[model samples]
Target: MPRTAPAVCSAVHKTDPDRPRRAADGLNLCRGCLKGMHRNLSDLPWLHAEVVTSMPTTRATGSAPVSGSRTPGLPVNLRAGELHSQMGHDLRTIAGWVAKDRGIHLPVDGRVGSVCAWLAKHVNWLAASQYAADVRGVLTELVGRAWAVIDPDRRPMEVGPCVELVDSTPCDGMLWASVLDVGDPRPSKIWCDGCELELTPEQWYRFGRRYEARRRMSA
Candidate 1:
């Protein structure tokens, strides 16, 4: 019998339809995606703590210096708080699902670190399960959100100028795409500063083709 082609990865980040798929032991996710998901789960707890420490009030750990003026310091970072809360919730929610199915008991205290540890131990199994894509998406999203708080200035790759048409003219915005770190899920962000145009992964190929055609026409 002829060998069947490997099934494409169903992970959310695998949006590049032209990319080749690799076999993954009959798992829903490819090996690279599975590894990235595992790494994200392992890093979630650390990222959660780092995001908390990134908050200005948390870092100060004391009352502000008296400046002899009635003024408010930086407003509390509600976004950071939300990220921290959501991280714990996501970790525990996934862990709870796994625990219920595997007959494993979660820690009574519901510590995020303990939950992360538990998830780390079972990530491989989780990657092979039917819910692999969902698990990967949740873990990757959590890690990405935490990274935004911890390192908002992550380096970007220049992707030439914006090729988006505005009233039959090309927008003059410079485009930059997010650079992915090792073990990061495939990055799909491509944005233009001048026009504030953002391209989804599905549009990247067509955008590139149009950009090259425009360039050749000018030359």
Candidate 2:
């Protein structure tokens, strides 16, 4: 028997060299990509639900006379509405294609949650088929969009120790930023756990610059 070359992952990643060449025997995507796809598929239902729930709506405060333009008011959050629709449409379209191709019975109602559950269940099976890249791409895009709408500031990070100096003494606390605050006006809040110091979103950049300067001076 002759040895065959391994198939490269079809999924695009930030770093090409780090992509795994050891894809499953019959799949074009690596194990990592497939795992991520499954996880995202599972999360899609929740994310889509969040997007729907978080959509901003307006109610008649007092039923004032509307004679200015005679136009109907639209949904307050058009972006959220668009995202919600796209998520459902994409999930149903892909699921339908997969069902037809695999001869599997899809959910008759084609609800977003049902379609997502179906996709998550057969993610590996899809990975082995010719539509691996298409499925992965769609899943990734939908997941990213869903997150952007519901939790745009979810990437909390430790921004190094507290650099706030009090009488030539640095506060012995750690500074962190980007606390999860869905629909919050102030998402980028930097705070210290030890000294109880806090910085607003507007001051975060200045604080970072000052911290860097302090580091340079100490070095």
Candidate 3:
């Protein structure tokens, strides 16, 4: 059976009108141009291989926007003073209590940084027993209240009726204590306390082991 040649488009012929017509060979190319066309097609595999090798495989996912770029779901305007005012109020409350207890009046400006530094330097020194007890009481009350404000589950632990003095020369007392839910480790220290009976080394060792055991059990 004689096979009829397929119809060729004028645009393809215009490019190579002198080329002779032949069977399509399923490649859509005339026989005359088929050799050149197959050569180009053969180069395509290598061309694709080079392109794939050059192209990067890994691309970064979504990243933080550069400065000044529009950010979705973020507040467009923030009031600087409003944020500071809230923080200042908390600090002023702490400062006010410290001033009243120590009998050293300081401006309760509601900012902790400067006021705490000033109080540390300027507060009047009292006898160790009076000072230690006063400081401990103040801290206990303030910390308990502060934690209660933020934490729904905060409960005050039953601290000892005894104050354990660690250093006597300068009267530094260390109490092995834990906050119920706040999870602050390392015992709180009350300084300048006039006391003779410091917790012995054995007591510290036992306390440390118990504390560790409780922590592991909780975990």
Best by TM-score: 2
Candidate 3 CA-lDDT value: 0.34
Model 2: lDDT of residue 156: 46
> What overall lDDT goes with each candidate model?
0.67, 0.68, 0.34
TM-score per model over all chains:
0.58, 0.59, 0.26
What TM-score would you give candidate 2 relative to the actual structure? 0.59
Q: Considering lDDT, where higher is better, how would the candidates rank from best to worst?
A: 2, 1, 3
lDDT of 2 by residue, 105-158 (tens): 888877788888778878877887777878888887887676666644453467
Q: Score residue 176 of candidate 1 by CA lDDT.
A: 71
User: 28, model 2: CA deviation in Å?
Assistant: 1.1
lDDT (Cα, tens digit) per residue for candidate 1, span 1-219? 743333766666423445544437766666557666655665677677778866644223244443454556554456678898898888888888888888989767677888887788887677667677788888868876776666455445678766666445555556778666778665556766434366776887777787799877866
Q: Comparing 2 and 3 by TM-score, which wins?
A: 2
Inter-residue clash pairs, candidate 2: none
